[model samples]
Target: MAHWFHRNPIKATNAVTFDFGGQASTPLARNICSEARSARSNLLTIFADPTRDLTVLTDAAEKYLSILRGFVEPTVDPNSQRPPAQAPNSEGGEVESMEVSSSATGDSKLRNAIKFTWSNTLAEKHSSQHDFVFEQINILFNIALWHTKHAAALAGAKEDIAEDDAKEVHKCLRSAAGIFNYIDDKLTVKLFERTGDGTDLDPNIIKAYAQQCTAEAQEVTVARAIELKHASNLVSSLAFETGKQFKIADNSLKAVEENLVQKWRKYLQLKATFYLSYAHCYNGQTLLAQDKCGEAVRALKESKTQFEKADDLGRSYTSTKGAGKSAKPHEHAFFRRLLPLVRRNLEKVERENGFIYYQKVPEVVPELPSKATYGLASPVEFVMPSKHEDWTAETYNGFKISKPDAEKREKEKDDAPKPVKEVPVNQTDKESSNSSGCTIS
Candidate 1:
């Protein structure tokens, strides 16, 4: 009887309910109760088990239906009038009838009644939160399929596993892929859009996702490695693009170029030496990597030297260019006159240092006298004395001689004889002097 009740609890419970209606039967009610409890216990055990075999689900579903059946009972009361038990229709008869009903009205009423009862029963037996619970169940179902595939693989029946199990695993993998794809799309869009706007998105997130994608690829077959590689390349490209954008936004190109030239120049020289040494050490001339390294080092060093020279020359040129528009004309003229002098001095220094000096000599102009006595002086001359003299006493004393010598000079001037006039020329003058001389005695 227990086996029978477990096999068909609904029929058993209905039989007991009908027997109680016709004749009072406490034994039948007790038997029905016992069967329902046993079935519920077995169902709970089956669900609690970790193994999710299809057989277990079928058993649990059967048990759940049995538990529902055991809850149905016939009410009994001798003093009160009660309605007759409605016969179970193929589609259960309506618990209530609607007045003034057309054929559509009658159908609608029956449908609403059935829907309400069925939904209420399902809710009461299950839960209001069943949607969330069912979703979790579905996820578990996928996980179960995944485990089954893994088990088959481990059991050496890899080929024999149902195609559905593989499909299930693929489905899960696809979900993970979708997540990655979404992130990739989002990052790409943001990267392109914000690139011009000059924003730096986090790089760590991209790196992490890339690692995840790579890790996920391990589960895939070798045939999919190429796909994985493509994905990885995309990630790498995005990272590179992001870094480049950041570098440009930061204006680090010039600084980086300068730094690289500075750093690599030394290594470049060593690189050539290193390659030659490597070749000799290994006794092989075909190893070109070392040579390339050396060449790179030398190239970088040369580049650095050139850059430094250019920078210095630029600074010097700018400094000597002078400043301001107003100062330019004067600066030009000054340089025009002084450039020859500067070049001459520079050449002299270079010559002293045993270097060849190649400066042009300036034309020499001879000094001219102030007086017109020299051909160099201008013909138009004023009576003004030479500007060489000043009125200072020192100038006057420069010409001073002895006073006696000065008088002697004067007497000599007096002692010099005057020239005598002819008598005929003074005859009238002599007669006039004799006529005027008589009154003077």
Candidate 2:
């Protein structure tokens, strides 16, 4: 039964719910790996045959979404009002099933007679909180990608997908966006928590995941524009958010590129460029839809330039020793595939609306200054030591200091003063004092 459920979750969930009558006593638990596998399989099936029935593919995606949501952000079950179950050792308690094997008895002694069943908590501890969410994001992205492609193909065939299951497609895209939004909101909370308390975890992981969510959300928004044949309100607003997300992602990728050296830096930079080009490409489409031909041209041009840069860097990264062997052929295939569309659209827009007000301007990014100049340890001042009237000081190869001797002065006062003739006294003898002592200051 577990194998069947793992293989087919949608039907299994339905069966379990029906058998238990929506109660929690049956303990219908979900396996994250199994769910992820099922989702990936569904996506691969769609990719295998793009012309497959959209209805079946969409149903599979929705089911996978439900399963994934349970993993990362499970909602309170409405039927969870029943009392909790006691432990297996208590009255009316249920023992969790476990497998036990027995070996042949040898010389009146039994081997492997006892077996212990490990609880679910042991497994749960091994999986980090972010792991499940990351997996879900990957699945959701593929689902959204499938929806976008299918919906756009339908739009192309029928001028608009509004009449033919448009609502379903819209729902899928919106769910994808919702998943992304949920991730972003929770990630913000996690970051705040880590900020207040010292945490050893690297925040770059969350930042990278946030970038994926934003990029996938942007893809959904762009697909919606394409399907609806308009981009005035919804698309325009989404473009603003998407652009901000792209900027954040760019900063994160810059940090990553800085940490790497030589070929790796170029490789990461190329990946960053590929991600940015998608944003630019979609933003260009949005601008063109709004009839801002000049801005649209600029965005599209930027997209094309980024594509060229990515290609060159990618080639450079691959030409290095050992990098080519591990290179992924589909690494930036999406960007490459989209570049021609951007170029074609740019030409179409220019031909329809002449490039009268378009002009390029050069911009420079100055290096950021060091923090030491105005930082906490800045504004230093020098101080000089002051000499006291009672002390004598000298510096040569070493410093010698002399201070008045109170005891010697008192003794001189106590003793009878000897009158000295004012005959010739050497300058050094006049400067010497028996009433003073010297110390390093």
Candidate 3:
């Protein structure tokens, strides 16, 4: 035996001591409890994650199938069994013949007999397995319905159900049909097992199920058609509005218009492609829906291209050296008149491109000379000098000497006699007297 210590005031001044077995059990229980709590928390965390939720859904589907299988068939107990009740005879004696005649003559009597026989057979065949199958069908149908509704809510089409939702509805109907098919097959199997022939048993149940499937499929088709029509109308309206807003005035605005047209065209082309693809999927031929979509796209693209070209022309016109600048004073007036057209076109582009159309236009300065350099006079005159003659200082000041005064001064200087030089008076007299005497002798 193991001894356990007890705390006593007399022994060690301790207040008390617990039994070893109980104390050991307490620690073990706490450890187990702590582990269990941690496991539960971890499980809860995993369940909260979305990925885990999808996995759970899948698992649930599989489990539902298992439950369905269980309902479809069950093991029969060998003991405590009783014989089935005897059914009324169809041909029982003259009293019997009379009785049979009475039974067969009335519709209500005949119907009741058939119903009772059929009910008895069904009860005999009923199994947990069949119930399980029904449960599985129900579960799948509900799950599909839930997914459909969830998707519809997400799409903001509370009133308008999507194709996928419609498909789910079909699936549910098909599941119901499947239940009937299963029962029919089971009935056939039982008939064959009992009489080695199943051709004689009525196929009303399977036929009815198939007919229901057909009806559901038709409904889905109708729903899809309606949805497609609505979508087409919406897209058409948008495309029309886009086309209406583009304008073609002024070079800058024209460029914007062209770009917008191109964008709109591309958008139309994309939309048409989508519609054509949808048409192909739906196998729709009514109204030549696919062809119309293609045509619309092409037409829009061509229109956009033409608009772009027009814009290019406008840009070229405005971009010319003297575009905004006028040689005449009235040119500004012309531009002012055209300003409205430019504004309208710009607005059109803005509508088409959304935020992209609002981009800044490049700054363009007019080429006209500044007013300070070129006077405001019309028919500007340029007075050029007669020739490349050098201008004298006086000529530059606008003061000129008269030609007659210049000529008079020149003649006076030329005609005036030179003064005679007087030699020394004595030398000059002697030379002159000697020359005179020589000439006289």
Cα error, candidate 1, residue 137 (Å): 14
* Superposed model 2: Cα runs more than 4 Å off: 1-200, 232-240, 250-300, 310-333, 349-441
Cα lDDT tens digits for candidate 2, 347-407? 8666645645353321321111122111011111111112111111111101111222346
lDDT (Cα atoms) of all candidates against the true structure? 0.25, 0.36, 0.26
For model 1 the TM-score comes to 0.18
For candidate 3, the TM-score is 0.21
TM-scores for every candidate against the unseen true structure? 0.18, 0.33, 0.21
Clashing pairs in 2: 401-438, 402-438, 403-437, 405-435
Ordering by lDDT: 2, 3, 1
Name the top lDDT candidate: 2
Question: On a 0 to 100 scale, what is the lDDT of residue 404 in model 1?
Answer: 22
Please say which candidate is ahead in TM-score: 1 or 2. Answer: 2
Which ten contiguous residues of candidate 2 have the minimum total lDDT?
1-10
Per-residue lDDT of 4 in model 3 = 6
